[model samples]
Target chain A: MIQFKQATKRYGPTLALDNITITLPENKIIGLFGPNGAGKSTLLKAAAGLVRLSSGNVTVAGKAPRQMRAHLAYLPEQNTLPFAWTIKRAAEFYRAFFADWDEDRYQKQLVMLNLREDMKFGHISKGQLAKARLLLTLARQAHCLLLDEPFSGIDIIARGEITRALVYDYSEGQQTMIISTHEIDEIENLVEHVVFIDSGRAAVFGDADELRCQEGKSIVTIMKEAFRHGSEQVEHV
Target chain B: MDFDATRPIYLQIIDLHKRALMTGELKPRDKILSQRDFAQRYNVNPNTVQRAYREMEALGLVETLRGQGTFIAATEEMLDTMKQDMARSILDSFVQEMKILGFSLQQALELAQEAWQEEESRL
Candidate 1:
C-alpha cells in the first residue's frame, strides 16, 4: 500500500503537486488522470521515488518510496533511455542493474514487443518501444508499478493484452499498480481506483466503484465537469 | 454493436438490447452477455454495463437470478403491445424526418414499396 500525506512539490515558481493526501491500497489498479498540465507525471514520479517531495510523505509498503526502491518499478513519461542502445541492450541493462530482474520475464517481454535479439534499438517505432517498456515493466511482479502514459499511441490489441496481463499477472492482493493515462475509456474497467488532479490540486480521488455509485456519472463525464467547475472557480479569482 | 459515442454508453447498450427484442433478433428467455464479459468485449466501464443490465431489468426486458446470470424476460401481451406502439413511434419519426428531407408522399410510398419488395425477397 502507498500513502500520501500532504505531499507537495515545486518546479521553479509553479507548484506541481499540492499538499495532497490519499492512501493507495495494494491489489488495485489506480489511475492518475488529468488534462494537460495536471501534474499527473509529477505525481507518478513522486510515487515512484524518481522525484523528491517538497513536503509530506509518499510511503509504499510501510516505507518511503526511496527505501522501497527494490520493490518499486517506475517508467517515466519521457523515455530517458539512450536511443543508441537496442531494445535487447536496454533489457540487458535492466538485468545487470536490478538484482531481482527475471530473465524469463525479460525474454518474454522481447517476444511480446516483437523485437528480435538482433533488432537495432533506434529502428523501432515509438509505439513498439512503448510496448517493449510495458512488456518489461508489467512482467516484473514488482510490489509497486508506476507507468506514466502507458496507453499513449498504442493500438487496441496491444492495449488489451497489457491490461489483461496486469489483471492476470499482478493481481495478487499484495501489489499496487498505478497507471497514468489520458485515455480512460479503455482501462476504466481494469482500474479499481481513480485520482483526478487539476492545476496541482487533488480534484477527486476514490474507489472506482464507489465513485460510480455516488457520482452516478462516467469518469470521463466527471472529469469534464470537474475541470469546468475548476475553470469557474478560477474565473471568480 | 455499432452505436453513437455521445450520451451515456449504458444507454446505447440498453438501446441495442431493445432493438434486438423489437426486431426478434434476440428472443424472450434468451441469454445475453454477462456484465463482465460485456464490459471487456466493448472496452467500456463495467459499472456502465451493470447499469444497462439493471435498467433492462427495470424495464422488464430481462430478469436476474441471484447466482444465475440474467436472462431475457419472457414475452408478455402488454410488452408486445408496447413494442408495437414503440415501433409506430419510431416509424412516425422517420416519416416526419423524410418529410423534412423534402420527400413527397408519392415518392415516399414508392420508396417504401420498393424497400418492402427487397426485404421480402431477402426473406
Candidate 2:
C-alpha cells in the first residue's frame, strides 16, 4: 500500500500538499483525479520521492518512498526524455537501468504504440511522445506505477490505443497503478478505485463501485460533487 | 455492449448478458467469452470481468465447467424466472416514472397500450 500520514509539501509561499492522509491499496488501478493545480502531481511526486515533503511522511510498501524507489515506476506529466535520444537509445537506456525491464513487453508495446525505433524524441509529435513515454514506463515490471496525466495532449484515437495497451499489458493485478488525470471519462472503466484531491488534500477516496452504489451516480458525477464541496469548504475558510 | 457510467461495471456486464439472452443474441447453453477476452473487448480490467462472471454464476444465469469456459444456463425454470424479473424491473421503473409525471395507473396503462399498438403497427 502507498500511504500518506499528514504529508505536507510547500514551495516557498505555495503549499503543494497540505496534511494529506490516505492509504492507496495495492494491486488495484487507482484513478488519482482532480482539476488543475489540485496537487495530484504533488501526491505522485511524493510517492516517487522526486519532491520532498515539508513534514510528515509518504510510504510505499510500508517503507519511506525514497527507500522504495527501486519498486516504483513514475511517469510524470511532462515528456522528460532527452530530445536528442532516439527511441532505440531510450529502450537501451531503460534496459541498462531497470533490472525488471522486459524486452519482450517493450517490443510488444513499441508495436502496440506504433512507435519507430529510429525516431528521435524531438521529431515525434506530442501524441507520439506521450505514447513513447507510456511505453517506456509500462515496459518495466514495477511494483507501484504512478502515471500523471498520461492522456493529456493526445488525440482521441491515441487515447484509445493507450487505454487498450494498459489493459492488455496490465500485470494481472500484481502491480499497483495510480493514474492521475483530469479527464475521468477515458479511465472511468479501467480504474476500480478512485481518489479525488483538492487544494493538496484528499477530498474523496473509496472503491469506485461502493461510491456508485451509495450515491447512485458515476465516478465523474461524484467527483464533480466532491470538487464542488471542496471549493465550498475553501470559500468558507 | 453500451454501458451506463452511473452503475458498477460488473453489474453492467451481467445486465448486458441478460439483455443478450432476452434479445436472442445469446443462445441457451452457448459458451461465453473468456474473462480475459471479455475484458479486452470492453476495455476494462480483467478482475472486473472475473467479478461479473462470478456474479452471473451466483445468479444462475451461467455455469462454468472445469477445464472449459462459462456457458449460459439452459434450464427452463431459470430462464423463465430471469425473464420475469427483467420485465418486472422494467415495468416498475416505467410505472414509477409515469407516477412522477402525475399520471394515474389506468391512464398510464392506456398510454402504454396505445404506444404498444403503434410499435406493433410499425413492425
Candidate 3:
C-alpha cells in the first residue's frame, strides 16, 4: 500500500504538493487524473522516489519510495532514453541496472507491441517511442508502477496497444499501478480507483465505480464537476 | 460497442447480455465467457465484469457453476418477459421525449402508432 500522511513538497515559492494525505491500496489499478500542473506528476514522482518532499511522508509497503526503488517502476512523461541506443540495447541496459528486470516480459512486450529490436530510439515514430518506453517500464517485475502521461501525443491505435498490454500483461492484482493522464476516457473502463488533483491538491480520491454511480456520469464529467466546484466535498480520501 | 458514458458500465453489460438472450444469440445453459476473458475482451476491469455477473445472477438471468463458468439461465418465459421489459423501457423514453416536444399523451400514442406502422412497412 502507498500512504501519504500530509505529504508536502516545495520548489522555492511554489508548492508542488500541499499537505496531502491519501492511502492507495495494494494490487489495484489507480488513475491519477487532473489538468496540467495539477500536481499529478508530483504525486507520482513522490511515490516513485524521484522527488523529495518538503515535509510529511510518502511510503509504499511501509518504506519510503527511495528505499523501495527495486520494487517500483516510474515512467516519466517524456522519453529520456539515449536516442542512439537500439531497443534491444536499451533492454540490455535496463537488465543490467534493475535486478527485477524480466527479460521474458520484455521480449513478449516487444512482440506484442510490434516493435523491432534493432530500431533506434530516434528513428521510431511517436507511437513506437511510447510503446518502447512502456515496454521498458513494464518489463520490470516491479511491485508499484507509476506511469505519467503514457497516452499523451500518441495515436488511437497506439493507445489501444498500450491499454491492451497494460491489461493482458498485468500480473493479476499482484502489482499496484498508478496511471496519471489527462485523457480520462481512454482509461475510464480500465481503472478501479481514481485520484483527481487540481492546483497542488487532491480534489477527490475514491472508487471510480461508486463515484460514477453517485453522479450518473463518467469520470471525466465528475472531474470537471469537481473542478468547477471547489474540492470541498473531496478534501482527503 | 459504444457504451453510454452517463450510465454505469455494469448496467450496460447486463443490458447487452439481455439483448443477446432475447435475440436467441445465447441459449439457456450456454456458457458465457469467464470474467477474466470478458474483461480482456472489453478492456474493462475484471471487478466490473464480476459486478455485472452478480447483478445478472440476482436477476435470475445467469448462473455460475462453481469452477465451470457462468451460463445463461433465462428460460423461454424469462426471455419473453425480458423482451417486454426492454420494449417498455423504450416506450417510456419515447413518450417522455414526445412530452418534452409538447405532445399530449393521445398525440404521442398516435405518433407512436404511425412510427410502428412505418417501421413495419420498411421491414
Chain A TM-scores of all predicted models: 0.89, 0.96, 0.95
For candidate 1, write residues A1-237 as lDDT tens digits.
Answer: 888899889888888888877777776678887887888898888878888988887888778788888888887777777778776777778777877687776676566456566555467776666777776676565778898998787788777766654544453346678888888876665566778888877777777666666667766676667767763342100
Ranking by TM-score: 2, 3, 1
- All DockQ scores: 0.08, 0.70, 0.44
Listed in order, each prediction's TM-score against the native is: 0.64, 0.91, 0.84
What C-alpha RMSD separates each model from the true structure? 7.6, 2.9, 3.4
Over A40-81, each residue of candidate 3 has an lDDT whose tens digit, in order, gives 899999999888899999999999889999899999998899
Off by over 4 Å in 2: A234-237, B65-67, B94-112
Across A191-225, the per-residue lDDT of candidate 2 in tens digits comes to 88999888888878889898888888988898888
Question: Candidate 3, A85: how far from true, in Å?
Answer: 2.0
Q: Please say which candidate is ahead in TM-score: 2 or 3.
A: 2
Higher-scoring candidate on TM-score, 1 or 3 = 3
Best by DockQ: 2
Candidate 1 C-alpha error for residue A184, in Å? 1.0
- Position B9, candidate 2: lDDT: 92
On TM-score, the leading prediction is 2
